[model samples]
Target: MRILDRNIIKYKFSFLLSCLLLLSGEAFSEQQRVSLRWKPSQGAESYLIELSEDRDFLRVHHFYKTKNFRYEFNSQDSKFYVRVVGINADGGRGVSSPIISLADKFAAAPKVKVERPSTVVASSEELRISLGDPKTSGPSSNTPGSPNSQKQVPVSTYYRVNGGEWQRYDGSISLSQEGWNEVEFYSEDILGNKETPKKTKYLKDTTAPQVRLIGEKKGQSGLIEIKSGAELTLQVTEEGSGMEEITINLAARDGSGAEVNLTLSGEEAKQPIKISSSGIDGLSILRWEANDKAGNYIQSELPLLIDAKHPLCVFAPTEGKLREDGIYYLKENGLIAIRCEDPGTGSGLSKLEYKIGNGSIQSYQNPIGFNTGIHTVTVYTSDRVGNKAELKIKVNAIKPDWQKTGSELQEK
Candidate 1:
């Protein structure tokens, strides 16, 4: 009769011999032999090997009866548990050794790490990669002849940039590309275990934001002339790292007054703003600075002169001179013309009208001629923004030379 009770066999053996896991042939090759060896028992003639997918050994994967004390097999998965039992020649089973997990004793894959910037940058930066020991979990067996008991070091590190050819990592890498970049890396240990490939990404921006000024009334002599309540627009754009902030400084050109400073966000800076001449009248300088997310900036200045007052009007003789006798003498073609100018900054003349003594109002396109007597001229003018000015001038003029000669001949 065969003795098959495992309970009787468990108490019959005093101690189970220590087990050893060894690897033969190439480290990670397909034909590598994963062997389990143990000390021979006194009354055992053959050994029984049992490999299970679970730790409890409830589900046996492989059962083999061998005459030798060692068993060799190829591992299809990364991890499993195995146990060995001593069998007597009478078909009776001896004590079974404790189940050992292959994952706790096998050589592990190397760990790879890539270091790069986390934020957006304005220029190229350096990238570096390193290799380290693989991480392990659970309590280590720390038994003699165990793979985890010894230290393992990575032998090589490999990397690729932007999906290009793979290369061994030797030194620091530079991200010189203008746009987005990607780097993939892996490490191999001395045991020929390769780590899973890892990827990292970053951005490199070398262009600055574009700035433009619009909605100005006119530009002249390195200055942008505007009315009191004119609209000025500042436009800024960036394609790479979007816009960040814009700062505007308005200071008096003469450097004798305080400055008016304003700040705007990326979205708000693209709209039009009103420039009031109530406080900042006369000549002023508008300096602006625009910045992007990549820490790149552009600075510029625009000279501005605010015109807030009405235009000045005056009447002057074109070809006549005032005599000592309180009368003004002029040639036959002598005439008086209206001259108009802005009081502050120039907003340009919009309307210039004049009337001779109680005459009908007329646009002042040419100089006005008067009869041989004292006369009064009324002038009215306005600027582009409706700033008006009116003036009245008294002029004393004599007849022309030809008229005076005809009068002398008539008297003779």
Candidate 2:
């Protein structure tokens, strides 16, 4: 008999729970009062209502118990989640109702449109958007304000071309599908608000001005040895939005103070600018900007590999005499240096790191000499393109031969 009673109780609880969840989720204005209503459960004597801002009822903000099926809630944001339960006269508790948010309780739909980037996507493919309509008061996006000053902000959803996955639109929007593509966009705000979807149609052209450079930037990747000057010629071809103008500027990166600049405009732009690598060697930056008739522009930059030769490195002691074992003896202490030079390049020798005997590696700036000790000098150097050379020489400072001879006679 007890088992039968337990089963009966469970069935009654489940029945009431179902009734609570079956209520209408939307808010209705009755007698000028906003409220939610539901049908009463069969065996329930009273209903329990729960409301919260979160989908999960863990942080329920309001709780109500009443005999009537209708429940009035205090919702400031008009946005909330709700659930209900029923309690019977026999102490049977019904299941909880399915949770629903009230954010759209009294909101209207929205209309979106493509506002900026000139409606057409020729110059740029990215889109700027704005929202319209959905009547609501208090800090709303539609409130009266300056065209530049916005009173409220809305959450936007982006539907890229080809019915792609939707994402929150953070002001700037883009269409992945180029050419003529149909993209959808919409916006919605909290507090019972949302907008309808608006489709945007446009075209995208991403082609830039074509470039034809001399030597084709190939077959010169290995060791570059240029004794004389290198002449560069360039040609540009553009279709659709014809080229308005083109300019190129070159800057040296080796801190050798080298620069090249050129600009051409209008019908006189057919002639290519001259680029002479006579003095400007090493790594150089070449920037080109081309403007079209449709107010569109293209910018391009390439690291120019100028034709130049590596510097010649020679180990000639500034002041020392050659001795045995590749060692040079300095009669006294002074200075000595390894000479390096790049005859044709603009930026000359790039690297000059050397390691002296039992000493840390240092950049060879000026001449190097020992105060009073046997010295082993090993130097490593290279040009901008990594043309490397190494040299090792041992040097020593010794007493003068006259001093040694005089000392020997006195001792005898």
Candidate 3:
């Protein structure tokens, strides 16, 4: 009986030891894989992952699953109970945490960075620059095999002109104007990482041609006395590029009352234009116009009066008809007279040229004789000032025969 009791006790002890070993084996098998994964929920909605130690949820490990289903947990903790909750598109929560232990999960999230350009200048000609993806920083992605694994990110740059409108500039554009121009650059990574802030730079230019008229202002008017064969002078200066050429025009009122053109030859800035008036007559006004290499223009009018006067005919009489006998009697009478005067310069009438109705012009000294017949006599006279006068006359040539008879009767 004693032997039997000892055997039963040993058997019980063995069974108890076996049950403890089984429990130990199950505990050892529960060692977590250190990785994590999950089957996406219905409708491809994202799932929220959480980790905690006590079932009461003292500390929660939160993770967002996008298109990816696997995540690696890097925490050194040996044992951690994980749970997943369904997340809706509207940020609404559907289910509370359903416990899942890391004992069987696989995978973890990798580190990501971004890249960008070193220096952004106002004169840079790049249209789009790639900031790195969520991997490397600073233009490293422009190289091959970089963390910026994807194609370059499209970048847009804008500029302000003197604090004015924001103008977009493409890659390969160059700055033309010089001023306090400001440029701002923007870039976005493939991973949706936008440049934290825009970059800016200022440009300055202190070089440009200085232009001025050396002798006169634009639209200046004054007497311009140039020798008959001398050149007219115009002084123009440009500090940087210097003056190119000059132009002058003899502007005058034409016969049709329009501004007529007369171009002067050999006109250059800072140079003289030799002009002569010996053969030129009746020029009313002269003017100078100038231009520079930059296409800027300056103009001045020369108020020059040229002396060119000529003799002019001023007067001639208009009336009178007489009988043939009266014309005959005037021809018989010696004294022939008519009133005459000079209008211009009012000088006395000098030598005269007389003609009667298609007759030859006859030169006469002062007094002239006329016949009796009805005569249409015309005379042209001149004064000392080269002005001319004209006169026409009808003279009575016949005397009454009754006057002769009455004298004869008185003698009888």
Total clashing pairs for each candidate: 0, 6, 37
Better lDDT candidate (2, 3): 2
TM-score of 1: 0.51
Angstrom error at residue 267, model 2: 3.0
* Model 3: lDDT to the true structure: 0.38
Say which prediction, candidate 1 or candidate 3, comes out ahead on lDDT.
1
What is candidate 1's lDDT per residue for 334-359, written digit by digit as tens? 88767887765666688999888999
Q: What is the lDDT of residue 387 in candidate 3?
A: 42
Residue 209 lDDT, candidate 1, scale 0-100 = 69
Residue pairs of candidate 1 with colliding backbone atoms: none
What lDDT score is found at residue 136 in candidate 1?
31
Stretches of candidate 3 exceeding 4 Å from the true structure: 1-141, 147-152, 156-227, 240-245, 251-278, 308-412
Span of ten consecutive residues with least summed lDDT in model 1: 129-138
Clashing pairs in 2: 103-192, 107-192, 110-195, 110-196, 279-346, 281-346
Q: What is the C-alpha RMSD of each candidate to the true structure, in Å?
A: 27.9, 24.1, 35.8
lDDT of 3 at 397: 43
> Per-residue lDDT for 177-287 in model 2, tens only?
444556676656554345667665543434556765655433243323332256666677665444557887766666565676877866645555566656665566667
Give the Å shift of residue 335 in candidate 3. 30
